[model samples]
Target chain A: MSDGDQMTPSRPVRLATRTVAISVFLLLIAGALVTSTGSGLAVPDWPLSYGKLMPPMVGGILYEHGHRMIAATVATMVGLQILVLGFRRTDRTTFRLGLAAFGAILAQAVLGGLTVLFLLPPAISSAHAGLAQIVFALTATIALRTSLFWSRFTDAAPRAAVEHGLRTRASRLALWAAGATYVQILLGAIVRHTGAGLAIPDWPLSFGKVVPTGAEWATDGVLAHFLHRTFAWAVAALVVAAALALRKLDAIPGLRRLSTLWLGLVALQVALGATSVWTGKAVWATSAHLAVGGLLWIAGVLAAVLLARAATLSPAPAAAEVGEPQEAAA
Target chain B: MRTDFRSDASKSMKTFPASRPLWGALVPLAFLIAACSPNAPEAPKAPAGPAGKLGTAVVAGRVTLEGAPPLNTRVTMATDPFCNGQHPGETELPEVAVGPDGGLENVLLRVTEGVSGVYAAPAEAKTLDQKGCAYSPRVLAIMTGQPLEIVSSDATIHNVHAAAKENRAFNLGMPAPGTRYTRTFEKPEIVPFRCDVHPWMRAFVAVLPHPFFAVTAADGRFEIRDLPAGTYTVEAWHEKLPRQTFTLTLADGETATHDVAFPSVPSA
Candidate 1:
């Protein structure tokens, strides 16, 4: 039912969409690097770096300007996807999806500009970061939908007797996980932006306690960091639940592999977060923490889409492997 | 990387980049023009500071703190090897520097009002140096249109960012040791300067229309000499304490000794 029979998949559009997704992810990391290095105000001008197209990349300028450059790259790739998807309106769903993504990217750019112009106010900066994840999830979903895997899965779905029910459960769980990851990302942004990442300074312990005390809560740094840690556990629980649910169905090796990847990313993301605070907010650790967070959001989204698609597709177990030469082929 | 992210932003900040070649050429030009627009305020003209030797009337003072001295915390400088190498041992920041005699260091005293006239800026330039990864003379005052030359003495990079409110803000990177850049403020405001590389490094500059301001010395003494006698409103500022202001009417050749004890009026 989710399938778009009108879509004539083009390899170039899919490749471009994936490229945009990857670039946006990198741009997010670059942005994290700028914040980690305290380079947001280094250039001190909007839509430009130091009154020039390219100021000498040195010091904070390197991180700040580098981020702008990557954002531009992401914009260009998104533009390319937009052109191909809307050409002759060949695929209405994909084209509309691309247009929506294009709109989000445009808004993302505005938020980015406003973040700089406002001298990095925490609220606006955090919003800028939050929207970036949305843009990433959108482009990443676009990539997933345009892929050969998506085409194959949708065409040959519901191959197992128990798959529909299991996928329905997994799809719901994955959606919740994605939402949790997004919330975690927002919390993490606050922690980073508010400089609360090291308020506790000790891992597996909050100033030597497993839980925050009343006195600790009085300190804003402690509160933000505590909330980030607490939300992370919730996110991990949902992701693991979804992964296990997918595994329970024992159908679609690809979905199983994606779930495993999500589980691995969750574990790695937590470690990077700890590494960030433990290492005194090292650029690499904090940036990777952000990068991994972006990936988790996208992966959760992909899992949700694929599982939901698998659950709703027409049952075609006999023709799944051999292909429907008579019906689908024509 | 962890060191970079581990800042206690709750303590000091409520916080939180790209692009092109030919496209960059045009876009940044537009921004540059907007920055250079005439909407910015102009500096007061003619005799803004004290006329040389015009008045013997002097406002001398000691700024003292009533409360316990601030706990100067040790800043983590491990992120930059250059900064770390500069301080081999534990170093506490001069957040509240009080001499043994209780004279507070780094309190800025300026004639805020009742002294009117366009003050000509001196030709000699004021210097703001970044040495040993610290800003020299943490608090200073300058007349509007007076050039402030910013220089870096550390081999590492230091971006001098002026957190200006009444004037156009600027952020410029001084990458190498002895890299010098000059700028002037066109408005009267208290501008806070900071280094992005070393968050603990801070300096404050009071850009005044007149040269009637002085930062307290190490012994908590501040003397703004040769003031043209007149009624004036003097304000004293300390980073850790509330700013205190006093009203005085000094006659020609009169030296007024004023003492400021903080936990200022409002706080008291």
Candidate 2:
């Protein structure tokens, strides 16, 4: 966006904002830990672990209650972020973004509570996991928007970016990639929550076949696993396609760097996914896979937002500048 | 709109302290989150078991199906080659073992209520053997706080994941044959025990306080001997059917008979 519309906050404010995103990402890893270690139902109470605010952090209770404590902390951080935005009372757009983030985090916390209270129903648990990505992306975006880099970043003129329609093309591709990545995360959540991560048993191949069929199709576990694997490929393909398409474009240097990072994250995600399976869903490997998936999702979302912003980068033109009939038709 | 971001950025650092409100906000939320859990079980409320001489009363019963039994789904063990090799080609689980006379097998009978006195757990640990890649004694009954020794006979990797809610849940892997693991549950709940390595392998563990419990045999006959003479509440539980609860009274050296039939379940 143009410098005039950019929301610039000080370094400390930016760091405080990024801290919320970092904590939420850490919370995501803890949630993954709860599922990876089969500890989802370890803490047998709502909002409390073993009826206490803090139970003996032994066995599975460690993962389950650890997630809760982090979640509680995340909620507080979100509330304080909104309060800080309000206190500044400058950058009204960021204040609104903070308000939106507050709403999302609250919803995320309530979903988490319901997931535990209801004994980790696959649907609620999956929703809780899926929303975590959104919450992280939101907070991350707030942090991104408030950074000095964002304030200083001004794009080339619309006339330059509009020719070849590279800006429009890159933005569309990035949005599609982001959407696919989010769906892939949801599918991964389903695979985790339904106890389907190991349903196929054999990694890189399902029951020693390219495509598993027959009786396994009738079970929820196999079905969830198959869908997740299938959709992961789709996500990877979309991301690479976006990155490749953006490579042919020009004038969006920030987005180009992000595209490369997105590609690298996707490759790491695939390797982690396989390693997680090969390790028999080991706590560390599976948790790492999920953690990497969280990072990949953040990058995907950031790329999309950045590309979209860059596509419309030039400040809104005056009424006299609307006479580019060729560009408008294209 | 006049926007001077450089000056605004300088002003923001002076305006905000992020930690103070965060700590203040967390305290109230913590209290609210803990509100619903006021009476959650601390630790399986003092183990309850029979604490007197074993009586001679016997409760014999036959559980018959009122209608046709549901078709047990074909269990696929293709994921684990060892399990798949043990039972070749599409094996149906023994969940719905119905005799010609409509007698149902694997129904668990427990005296859920009216059994008095806190009994001490038996010194001898109950063995839950995993043979033929399936949990033997598919429906097991044991006292709370009684040790359960899990032993696998298959020379393959297996893990016992007891998906217990009331009691602490555990997932222990058995990497080789004859690997033994012992655990004692503290609460009275039907724990669904399964081998995570073999998804098709599953069993139910009935953790009861007293010893007045029996599982239906091949012919659907269940006999629980040594139950004390008293009016006791017996619960008949089948995995797929609604549980049946009834009261039974017995005298010393008396043999009481109870015949129960569960409602028809839809065929697969």
Candidate 3:
């Protein structure tokens, strides 16, 4: 290993990063619960519940307040992460990512407050939900960058000139997949918050046909639902292509395993999405759909991070020697 | 190695300078835990017992039609096969029901004004049943604070949605037969309830603050007994006709008969 390659994060920093990531994941689930239960207006106040530090936990109030508490805990975890990064990490990119996450969380909190203060206007509520996925992706990225596997992999140089083009192509593919998945997530948020989940009223077809009958396209609900479904198909195609590209690259087995896992998650997410519509947005199905959507997004982000890290390592003769045996075995 | 990593992280968290950043995170969290640790206070109890005097005065009335009643449209339950199968024959919508004697059924009669007293809601729940993809007793009247139990008798799923202007709106799904749900309205208003799953199924609920409300029977007869006598404006509302009002002054123990007639219009 080169002297510069040895600069992986200490175990403490990596663990802290994972903690923040997990906290953000839990926060996402809690937020999804609030949306699923339609409890956004339970407390009817923000920053402070019912004009006090704590509000009565009853009915919808419990879900809404519980979501706030989870969000507050995540914010604190991220804040601690930032503090730790400032003191211990010298990597400018990681530090900046931490700062960006903190800013995203603060903005998310304000958006959440406004969503309640304004009685959950669809635009603000959708934005709040969308921003949560973005923040989760951010934290997930930080976790990936600080993991022991990432440190070990990035420290090792690439071995084959033959692997260079494949790695770059796979990284670009993963990035596209991640970007498309995020757009799909945002579209889904719009569909959900705007009460358009059941607009199409049928799965695998729109209104029992490939295209809805006349004037249906003009309706906002139908349009949003159609576009979300269409985008999901596109995202699925992109993810599948990325997974195939990553499989051909000579990289760490962990990255290969994660690529396969991403494929599986995307498949499960599609089933969940279908069930969400088929059941007319049953609370359990819809909530699970959302949770799986978040997980799919994290998987995509992790894949992109790993591929991007692979793209940076210098080519080495050992990698070329190792690639021949793997190619022959395949 | 993973265990060592966790312990090392905890050690770092402990040994990290007890400075502004560490305190900034911990203090608010500590305060949050402390503030939210207490269980939520119990909801305030409702007022005890009726706040009105008992009297023997009764408002007896019949709702008669002055013109031809609007034709009731036959409801099509094509959305759900179960609902459709339940009614092999045509089921007429109960928007307006007129008796052979020009007496109106399903007309809601209530004391609209001038009689003021706190009347405690009955502990018994008024049931609104969803059967054969239709709301039974299409027009219902209940005291404002009385619970309305909604039960579905259909094998198919039915979503009960109450769209009330003056009360909290609730939308619930009953996915199976015998599924029961209850809700209460705190304000006096005419709430339109519908089953979204069966778009044609609809009902209306007249929530009054007092018990001086009744729906006209099949024979167009209605009676509201036990009224503390005073000048009261009684209003009769029919779903398809303009409302009719009658003003009457009653003395203690006096039974007043005020018959109302609604001039029906063309079907909507």
Candidate 4:
């Protein structure tokens, strides 16, 4: 093996890594389309569409069957990626992550089946959604680590302390931000697939009253909806906080710019959500809201992964320098 | 007190036309009463059309099948008049079933109002035939206060039950094929029909106060006719779907047609 090849990957494998990442983003969009079209239950009975491999794609079958088709495609891509990573590449961490992504995809497919068989019980559906986001983030991380930009970050100067350093604070803040954003997305999925979007009606405030009106509390459906809206507020706050932390890290120009974009998307997402409610969940508005939410999630995960990797690599240059002498002795 | 009572009775006798032959005097008495009223001063004028040509309002539509058997179902349209008690004509069509290729027979039908301004068809008149242990048409539209006739043509007995939220619950046992009973829906609702005997047998009935509705045929076509020229909200409701509403304007001597297609169900 070549000296650089032993540490880094070959160009083809790196290219494959990028392809998988792009595919992950595509899969997220596909999932969003399924949700936007209200095709979650299109295939009424799961693991089969009307008890056949190819059922008529009319009505519910179109959405449900389409979801299955997309899922199967994603699964196949993940399998291929795993095989390529294991046999064709020597990077242990990337290979392991690929395996983890594959495992998650399988579990997600099972959860999806359970959701359909049980008539899309809310919890399973939310998990299916959440896992997809996680898998998406994982795929993205793998791609980021293999990119040329990541190599440039390797030689960047290390910062001092967690309180004052750009790398430390941004990394710490972004990890929390990613976690909160994911949970918020899961809550949104629950809100949507559970028919809770219209439960609260008035956006920013629910039922012409805030903190929930007692009279409507008796209806569980409405309560679920109210909770979803409230969680949206929490998500907004977290995004703003994440943006402020990014501003605090003045040294990392790329991350600061990325966080700004992330926050702007979040703001737009909040507006779209409001318009969706105001418009009485018009199909178009709801679909746009869903689409924007997916974008925000992707952005948040991207920001987190970049910052986290930056932190891990903060000590890498010094260690590499210390190890250079050992290589000379050898 | 006796004298006062006698005087009042004598006055009433003089005013009332009871002494003459009862039938003979009644016509004159009715005429005098009509003359005294200003609103009916001209008497009850008959409409200017042949009695049989009494303007017919039609609710015609097609029923299509998505899954399961091609349904041969019964669809009914009737009205419970709120303003006037008199409705001239009541009509019904035979059980119309869907074909294997998801085609439907035209259920062109009408209904007249019942006494007390409530519209109804006889239980024997309104029937949904279960020919091969399947609801002939998976959907039905009938007027409120009319009985839904569920008939079993199969050899085995079928227990018919309707899960209705706004109407009284009906659970009936059909003893055998050719045995039938009629159950009335006193209230308006969209009730889902089910046969407990055949778990897969499912149908829907929408009991409306006015007979201004029709189900779309397999070809996704529907026509509502003879509506008084005005603006009204026409709603399309499917048992398993959300209700879709459209506003329609009908001019006098004009028939308006409305079409509705349900968004396909999602694939599992």
TM-scores of all candidate predictions against the true structure: 0.67, 0.60, 0.58, 0.54
Every candidate's chain B TM-score: 0.79, 0.78, 0.79, 0.56
Ranking by lDDT: 1, 3, 2, 4
Q: Between prediction 1 and prediction 2, which has the larger DockQ?
A: 1
For model 3, the docking class works out as incorrect
Better of 1 and 2 by lDDT: 1
Docking quality (DockQ) for each candidate: 0.13, 0.04, 0.03, 0.01
lDDT of 2 at A284: 94
lDDT of 3 at B132: 73
Put down candidate 1 lDDT per residue, A55-99, tens digits, no spaces. Answer: 666556678878888887787778778887666344566667778
Q: Which candidate is the best by TM-score?
A: 1
- In candidate 1, stretches whose alpha carbon ends up further than 4 angstroms from where it belongs are A1-3, A6-10, A87-90, A315-330, B1-136, B141-160, B164-191, B195-201, B206-268
Off by over 4 Å in 4: A1-8, A157-166, A315-330, B1-268
Residue-level lDDT tens digits of model 3 in A232-330? 999999999998887786446476687788899899999999999888787788888888889888887888877666656664345456555655454
Q: By lDDT, is 3 or 4 better?
A: 3
Per-residue lDDT of model 4, residues B132-194, tens digit only: 555767777876666566676765444455656675554444434665555666566778776
> Candidate 3: global Cα-lDDT?
0.75
Q: Whose DockQ is greatest here?
A: 1
- Residues A77-163, candidate 2, lDDT per residue (tens digit)? 988998876775537667777888888887787777666544566898999988888889888988887776665553343434544
lDDT of 4 by residue, A1-330 (tens): 121323555587788888887776666666665666555544433344433456544433455566677777677777788787777754677777888988888777767766644445578888888888888877877776666666655445244223335555666666676777777787788887777777877867777777776678886578667766777777878778777887766465366677788888888988988998899787677777766777677777777776765566454345355455565454
